[model samples]
Target: MNLADTIAAVATPPGDGAVAMVRVSGRRARAIAAATFRPSAGKPLQPRRFTHGFVVDAATGTVVDEVVAAWLPAPRTYTREPTLEVTCHGGRAATAAVLQAILRAGARLAEPGEFTLRAFLNGRIDLAQAEAVRDAVSAPSADAVAMAVAQANGSLSRVIREVRDPLADLGARLEGSLDFADDGVPELDRGTARAVLEAAATRVDALLATAGPGRVRRHGLRVVLAGMTNAGKSTLFNALLGSDRAITSDEAGTTRDAIEEILPVGAAAIVLVDTAGWRPPGEMPVGEAERLSGARTDASIPLADVVVHVVDGTAPHHATAGRERIAALAPGGAMLEVWTRADLHRGLHAGNQVAPGDQFRVSAITGEGIQALRSSLHARAVAGSRGAGSDSGGELLTNARHVDALRRAREAIDRAMAVVAGAMPDDLLAADLRAAVAACSEVTGEMIGDDVLERVFRTFCIGK
Candidate 1:
């Protein structure tokens, strides 16, 4: 919380990799680097230049780790402060050594998101953009990354300012009319006030409409695979993943639990769950194990964005049972009928009687219809993410905090509009507009409190 003290942290993720970096920010950042870093090239640390160095202990004069250190001076850095980044060999020991040297040189360890928080406080980026940085780091798919990048680039903030500036103007007009009555200033008429507030509301509604798709983009879809036992669900799951993640056997009740993994289909990431096969609790030969698996599969049905009902194409009886099970288990989720083992269907008719679409047949052994099934899943996932009225150029509200603030802002604006329409007093209408302005300010960090800021930045990882 103390901006005056220099803070240091490992910028790269903790683990072994090709490279790791330690970041330091504050007035003393460059000085701390100078004390701990001895340039291998025998030169002093230069601004905005990477210098090869060996991090040395200040007191013992012992070499710590070989590194490349850079000094970014104040007013041009991420925090708009003197910042130092030390690139060392990737591993916990190397990063720790550099960080410890920084601490010995008087830089304290940074908390989670402290770097980004400093950027926000220093006016380099607003709060919405700060959240976008977090979103980009955790984005599961390319579409999510795109939305996050747009927000980080100030798309959402631009939209907020577009709406908030007009309301601020409306408030200023009301205040000026009230304060400058003797100066012959014109009052803001009810008609003009209503128009301005209504326009702002329309813009807010436009942003709010994207919250659904934005949420879906931020958090990928959950797709569950459900069907009766020995329906070749595991084989199909393995085929989709292109790896033998699930254990496939000739046994009927081998998969007694849900195996979950992420399958990136085009721009959408699907959290695919391969649940245990369905069976009546009392009828299951394996008793409790099968019963528990069935329960888990049923529980996952409601949580899925898309529930795929997989049935053996060779067995016509499974079609009816699969349909009944999907309808009874997952009433609200989108359902897809996938008939497996098409290569072994030796019957006269090739298509399923219940669902006779080309999209319904899939043979795990022969790899038939697998690509089509994947495409269908991708299409459905895209539809779930792209809400009504969503366009490529339009900005999206990806952060929940922003959405909540915008909703509150819209509610306040609605109240202000109603107040203006009722021929209310100028000060009363101004009060509602002020409330709306405050709510809007929270989204952009203009009028947010410390508590909200703490909650927002806490979701970020250390070193941002």
Candidate 2:
């Protein structure tokens, strides 16, 4: 946390790779680099240029590792401070040795997200952009990466500023009218103020509308496959994933736990969960492990964004029981009925009561209707993502924190609208406007507390 002391950390991921980065930033970044690194050409490190060097231990002067180091001067670097980055040969030992040498040269180890926190503190990027950096690095799909990249590039920040600026201006005008009443300053027009508030609310609502899809993009959609015992759930799961992730068997309750895998469907990712088949207690004598497995399946059902009720196509009784169980569970989200072993039974049985469009028949063994089933699941995934609205191909409000802040801002604006409609005192109206502006400012970190910053940045990986 001390800005005066240089900080160093391995910026790259752990384990072996082609290269690893050791980053040092602060007032003494250049000095630490000079002390720990010896340029191969007998020249000092140059600004904005990479130099071939050998990292040396400060105390013993032993060669730690050969590296290519870059010196970035203050005011233009990521932290707007003097920064030195040494790209050493990849591997835990080499990266660790390089970082240790830098620490030995007087640089302290950087905390989790301290590097990006420095960037935010130095005004290089706002809080939203800082969060976006984390999202971009961990985005699960290509679409998610695009959304995060756009936000990191300040798309969401621009929208927040657009909403905040006018509200702040209106609040200032209201304050001026109240304070300078006897000084002949013009009184603020209620209609103009109302118009501004309404416009700001509309913009915030648009951004809020993106929250559902934003969440879907940021965290893959949760899809659970549930059904009666021996209903072919695992086989269908493997078919959908194109891998044998879940074990299959003819014996009931073979899977005693929830098995999960990430399956990318089209542009979206699905967190596919295959759970133990459901059966009423006492209908079949079950052991403690089977009881726990059923409980786990019950637990996973409610959390799913989409629940695929897998039924045995050859068993008419299974279709009826599956429907009843699904109704009892009431997943409270999108639902699909998939009839497995379609190769054995070519069509829907008499027990299937679901509409034609909502049900699918597939055979995991013969691959019959497998692609069609995948397409149907993909369609459902896409539908879940579009619940808020159609993606306009712009920035999305992916972070829950940003969504909560916008919701609060929208509520304040609604209150401000009410104040205007009631012709309330300018002071009351200004109070609400100020609250709305502050809420928006919180999104951009223009008016945020240290606790929130700590909570936000602490989620980042060390050396980010």
* Worst lDDT 10-window in candidate 1: 347-356
lDDT per residue for candidate 1 within 296-400, as digits (tens), equals 888888888888888777766656766677777766557777878889885323334334443467887779889988887888778878857633237767778
- Among the numbered candidates, top TM-score falls to 2
lDDT of each: 0.84, 0.86
Which prediction has the highest lDDT against the true structure? 2
Clashes of each: 0, 0
| Model 2 CA deviation exceeding 4 Å by range | 280-285, 350-353, 386-393
What lDDT score goes with residue 249 in model 2? Answer: 96
Per-prediction RMSD in angstroms?
3.1, 2.3
| Pairs in clash, predicted candidate 1 | none
lDDT of 2 by residue, 130-166 (tens): 9999998887777777778888889889888888999
